[model samples]
Target: MTKDTTILLIGHGSRGREGNKETINFAAQWRERHPEWRIEVCFIEHAEVLLDEGLDRAARNAKKVLAIPFILNAAGHVKMELPHALAEARQRHPEVEFLVTRHLGMGREILAVLQGQLDQQIKAMSVPDPMTTGVILLGRGSSDAGANGELAKMARWIFEDNDHELVDLAFTGVTWPRLETVVQRQVKLGMMQIAIVPVYLFTGVLIERIKEQVARLQNQYPQVSFALGTHFGFDKGIFDLLDSKVNGDIEEGGMLECDGCKYREAAEEEHLHDHSHTAIGGGGCAHGHDHQHEHGHSHAHGCSHKHD
Candidate 1:
């Protein structure tokens, strides 16, 4: 609602040119929709406009800058690097106010996007029967086991909601059962068709990798049909989520169901430290305390994300 505010949508930059261009295109679309506020795009890495440059651009004439982390979740970038970067940027430009919106956490909206994409793939196919079909929810893997397990949770939810006979999870890199192996095994298990639904925000090198694997598998076994689902691009729901965050509707907190999270074991191994040792910044915790551990303090508002 503020007229002098600028919206800085920060993306996880991709090495691929197409990925960067796609982000620019999405920014253009957003600008068209909301002509009042000045909208800009920047990447954390592998792009022309880096975070500092973006801050410089956004603070040119604006009194307030609303920086939305256009990320899937609170991965390493969101948790540690992003906050550190913002802190520096704020120091550099003391005149301009910088506010970071929450990362894109898991919810019914994201599930709706996935389901919509899968539905489109199913409607396009001749045999859309769930009894003989399978779905693979592909994710960009992470070293954090809890983050990796989020994909497993999504797979379970998709299987429960949809009629898919089998819903499996696989990762493209870092950690996991590789996507190629899972697809091949599913074909061998007598799945007549399989849909690879990418749990990604946009097209990157990983999207290309998914396409390559799907093509290789399709050629290897022509009997088992393969279809590629869409990624979460500039969907209306994603826009709504970002808008909600900018409006301060969503609070900071952990988004994943972490009761059985492997990260919990890692977190529990350490003992809490004294609040007197709170670091320079807010310490990445909502509780206002700090500990000098390998993994930083937890925030109730942070979300989990895979390696970008």
Candidate 2:
């Protein structure tokens, strides 16, 4: 096994083109910070550059590779699809080492992002009602009962753990007290205005559908007011947070270079001759090709990320 290090940032495919855009953009930024590292972006489906292909591309002569899922929940894809794929990839490439980092689950920093959106939405409203202001913690619903249950538990932690002596909280889907139901109860309890903090990293069908749903609920209950919160975008702090996970996994794996954690500039001349990026499964696909209409590139074997 060559000592080469490779990282694969995997995300579930979305019909909404923007979701792909964000995942790709995030990959681009991460690459910029660690230009020396071999990085690539791939999807589960819908997108042409799927996970298997991405893994195949990044496995060339590289001794260690890290496959990190850029998912918010650990329920469905993370627990099932992701691991199975990684296992298969490892079996096919017995010489190369491949592993997965944890999904970006409920964390304090993520809550900080949510709270930030909520605060921004509330500020935009500028209403006089402080106690009457409420928050609807919106999340992409999952089929896994445990994951759904965890959201409620997360909301409880957020509302109570944060020490915010203001506003009421509720979950929008699955578990008990769905979005509309939460809205109804919160309204009955004297909170009239509400803001939705979508527990997603990017905006797309989920965001649009959520806004439409909230709008309908507002119209049905003329007594209540509502507005959608913000989406996560171009935050420098997020890079640092993700960086921590990368580093942690590397240290845990006991590699000479914690392939997951720190970012380093690739010695261009040194890696140019390395097969680590292309030595995995099959003949290389023509990656970095103009794949999408907007981005116009596949960003294969190249997972460069930047601040812009």
User: Against the unseen true structure, what C-alpha lDDT does each candidate score?
Assistant: 0.71, 0.63
* TM-score of each prediction: 0.79, 0.73
State the local distance difference test value for candidate 1: 0.71
lDDT of 1 by residue, 1-308 (tens): 58778888999899888888888998888777777768888998999889889888988888888877787755555554565567667788899877766667566777888888888788777757798798998888865444566568778888999888789998899877998888878877778989888998888888988888888888988888788986777788887777677677433441212212333323334432111111124423222123455444343544331211
Which whole-number lDDT from 0 to 100 does residue 15 have in model 1? Answer: 86
Write candidate 2's Cα lDDT for 1-308 as tens digits.
12387877888878899888988998898889977767878998768789888888778778878877777765545544555567668788999888667766677767677667766877777853656777777776754544555566667765774433334444445445567777777778777777777777776776787778888988888886777875684566567667776676443453212122111122122221111111124422221111122333233553431211
Worst 10 residues of 1 by lDDT: 271-280
Q: Candidate 2: where are CA atoms >4 Å away? A: 1-3, 127-129, 161-177, 250-308
lDDT of 2: 0.63
